[model samples]
Target chain A: MTKPTGPSRRTFLKTTAAATLAAPTIVSPSIFAKGDTPAPSDRVVVGSIGVGDLGRRHHLNNKLLVNPRIQVAAVCDVDRNHRDLAANDVLTKSGKMPGVYKDFRDLCDRKDIDAVFVVTPDHWHALVSIYAMETGKDVYCEKPLTLNIEEGKKMVEVARRYGAVFQTGSQQRSEGPFRQAVELIRNGKIGKVQRVDTYIGNIDAGKWQAPITPPPELDWNFWLGPAPYADYFPNRCHYQFRWFSDYSGGKMTDWGAHHNDITQWALEKDQSGPVKVRCEQAQFAPDGPHDVALEFDIAYTYADGVELHCHSQGKNGIKFTGTDGWVFVSRSQKEFDAHDKALLTWQAGDNDVNLPRTETKHPHHDNFLDCIASRQRPICDVEIGHRSATVCHLGNIAIRLGRELQWDPAKEEFVGDDQANQLVGKPMRAPWHL
Target chain B: MATVTELAGDLCSGDQVKTYQAQQALARLSGEIGASGKEAEKAEAAKALAAVLAGVKPAKDNRGEATVDSIKSVNSANELCRALSLLAGEAEVAVLAECLKNIDLRETARWCLARMTCQGAADALVEAYKTATGTEYRVGLINALGRKQGSNVLETLKLAAADKEPEVALAAVEALANTPDAALDAVISSVESGSSSRRAARVARARVRLGSTLLRAGDDAGAKKVFTAVAGADVDEAPKKAAAAAVGG
Candidate 1:
């Protein structure tokens, strides 16, 4: 579905004001208005799929549970402890018990749930999000969107087919500074774009640990889901899973999904990708729990003649260098700046381009809810998410194959490399095929 | 998990779930078996697959709900074909080539034939491409041959590159692009001297993209050469300008 050409601020305010009179449950015109919580009917009913580590800290605790605009209706995770903790946390805050589900499928089947925040391991993203969408639920799937290129394609197809509102969890798209940076670049605040340099953290060269029995709280098989089967190793699950090829694409996709995503948005290349990808240098462990690139310097060439250089050595953010100036933004640094400091402070003239803006402090989930109401594509639409993730996946594939690849962005395939095409759609373990 | 033999037996099972699981397991094991350490072991695995295919026949049983049952059957056949494709030999290729007639199995059968290591694989596909009447099937076969990994397959792709069907020609041209230095030159020649404006446009786009990639990688001279070539071609203005931009015109 196309991105919604949302109403102007004045029209949105007027429409919401009228809507508030007809439905007292509508939140006030000021989203962060302090007076009162919106009526229960006005709240977006959200369920959370994974409640472990980052999911709990960022989405469940900080956003879903605390946000008055959302009512946490259910919590699902393979781990009973994490699910129970999340449900309890919601209960304490809202004084209402959320349904606890062992299987995310059961959570999706709930009629009370309007949307789901899919924070599962990378392998489960497509399955949970697609199923939820098919069941008439909107999805806020965590990035990187899918385990393979095929999965992402299927996800985009199913979401559109079902008319589902989807928002990928590349939350940077919602941040004010990122939007401002992209706007500046899009408006040519930096003269004709030269190159984008992105730095994701170095890969963790982990060795395959001896197999250990899974803890009682974890349903290991369910967690593995569509990925190939492997014996249990604690580090190969949860937050540490990012380093493994089986479950994740290492830090390249982990952080790359975020920074590389912003780079695509700034370049206005979200619908397309680089025509060529080459991994200049990389080191992979001989055998391991992780087989991703330990160090990498990959280069991509877009059809428009712009270069996107990705590496592990540079600052852990994105640098957009244009002929006039360059802007650098890093999440960890909690700062964004430009070569000419004045560029950061530059204001757009009346004719200058301005991207859709969101309310200050409005978390990404709010954007998902807003789109659900508006029936529009979110800031990080499924197609946008897939394209960005494709960039990261291409880099990983190049490094692993130790060759430069000619990519047909229109076809979304390696020009003629049968071997590389084989890696594009990974074979799922039985009963889990897409 | 069932052994390959056990799963192969279950392939003929009446229960749909068992059959599905068996198909998946066999397909997975075939890839492993094809790559097994011992050559004799690999050959035996391929033979076992041939035996399985010889006995298995496509069921024409039309349930009232054709969509659901057919979808299930197509999916199962897809997995079965995948298993056989990974391990097919000369004998297996013949069996898979025969499967190309079955509408539900044709795509997967062609895919299997392409990936088979049998010496006859490419020849079998070229023969099939000649006899195949359906445009989609011919296109599939052309793509399969295009993906083959040798110089021996280039002549067949070159012939298909001149096919009357634009789709067929485009597929062959795409395959030519995949070949290292030699075949790419052939593709450029075909496009440069060819009469099809559409095919020429496609080739020019790829050529300009190559130039753009070269420029991005800091190879100014290489980029300039690619851009210079395409800039003079009968391409749309967009690619010409893109080429000039790559050369800083």
Candidate 2:
């Protein structure tokens, strides 16, 4: 935080880092960024999948319509309520009610839509995207890429085969410090990037079961989707999925996909992978029906000798360790000092307005749209999302198997151990096939 | 390092000679250091940053207005509020408050109304409330003024507390806690309103918080007055809620 305290002001447009990721009332990634936007022309006919809590938030935060270049054409969710909210929002804004669907597949099958936004839980990320791409629709899938490693790889394969521009919703790469940290590390600011200390807030692991009380508004079976069926815990659906093993990788993937992705990016590897992972978890909180690890520290080592340390702390941020002084970045709108500002400037010292630029204008979505329009890879591409997600899945696998496992970052698989290898990809419950 | 007066003068006076000198000193201090852990050096760095402010002109709008025009060019309410807040203290606060009235910068007027303790704030807050009716800024104005003059402003606030509007009534009740000793009992009694009692409770809570400020300032009598009220009352209720905010010994 620049000028941490006081009523007076002087510093040149410095803001705290915490405000960066905060979802303001109804922010669409569109409402913020200044110039990366290209005249808001050539609209992408977009549709949504799994419009529950996240569906509404994504719909609200996406500034695609503000560009006048994008149109939300269809909405789909297991719940009519979820779909209606998004459809209504689009209808109200654009004077066109989107075709609503109770089944995501129905939405994915549509030929008119140019893009599909898969903001469903981790499990549905792969299933919906695979189908969306099969039907010739481009996709913007939400974080943790997929439920497990193999699905992530498959999703990547399908995306590549279909010639679809797949952008993962790991928006951190769209942030300035994250990009700056990577640039500094890639350009050798931290010298030889040897270690990374990543903190993504607290998330405890284990089973959580709430009273099977079903809200009249909820469609529980459809909500559970591909996951192994459990009692209808409303908290487990829509919002609290991050706390469970079935749908989410706790905060490891929730916030980890964000910070960890930056850690790996700063290490100069998006297509490459972290070779080994060891996990140490502490279950400090009682399992109140949520299953993700609450307090844990997982250390990830790259094959080339770089080690990334990820831990759940009270605060959330990413710290990159170059051989020199480390640069710590919080996912906030905090001001950068002259030193931090230098980290954001391009290696060329001008027009580095891409991901991790110095300006505080929220530019994540604009980058995605720019890539979509230009048919270029976005700052956070599908491969980058899979790699970041692999870090989280590997940590989960180590913790779940109660042992460390060697990984092939190149093949995207576990190395010698058959038992741990099996856990890399999970089976999708029938009727919800990917 | 420049003295406080020199820092303030360099900031307000449009003197380039002083500005250039200050910037050079700041750059050297920021650049020459290689992470010295010495407390004195850190203090010196802070002093250098402070000196930079000496010639720190008011951060202008992209349009170069000391303040943006309310009728046009502003994009977000937050931006407007931020500009108003910047005007509150970073530069000339009173002038900004006065400007809001003529320009009809409603959001900025409301923001500045609650924030300012300068002499012009009281009149502005009252006017903003009269025009906007049922807004939070009026209470922010009354309470901000109350924090400055306490009971001296109680009679003026009593009308606001009794107003038919609930939010304004709540603000009046809050201001009541800061009322003069003569009105303290009335402020305490006013906590009976079902809708506005929480405001009274918070007012009582403020007294608890104000205790240390009074004690630190060597106003032990005022500190004791608040502390005694909290210690003797129901923990949840206010006016008597003051003790929790004070140090026991």
The candidate that wins on DockQ is 1
lDDT of 1 at A227: 63
What does candidate 1 score on TM? 0.63
**Clashing pairs in model 1?**
A207-A289, A208-A289
Count steric clashes of candidate 1. Answer: 2
The 10-residue segment with the lowest total lDDT in model 1 chain A: A21-30
Model 1 regions lying over 4 Å from their true place? A1-36, A332-335, B1-249
The DockQ figures for the candidates are 0.02, 0.01
lDDT of 2 by residue, A1-434 (tens): 11224422111111321243242212224422454332322446788777777666654435544544466778888777777777888788778788988877677656567787888878778878876775667788888887888788767765654456788887777665565556666666556767778888885433444346677666777777766444565566767777767788888888889888887777668898788887766453441335456778888788889888888874577666666656777766473322345554535244332233323343555555544544555567788899889898888776655556789988777886654565676544322333
Interface RMSD of each: 14.7, 30.1
| Model 2 chain A lowest lDDT segment of ten | A8-17
| DockQ-based class of model 1 | incorrect
Residue lDDT tens for model 1, B15-116: 444654565455335434433254566567667766665555554656554655555445555556655655556766777777776665666677667656
Candidate 2 on B1-249: residue-level lDDT in tens?
A: 674335434423333334334333332233233122433553444443333322233334443454434222121222223222312332343444444444233333444344444445555555444554325445445544444353335556666666665555655654554433433434544543455434444445444434544555677787677677666766433224225424355
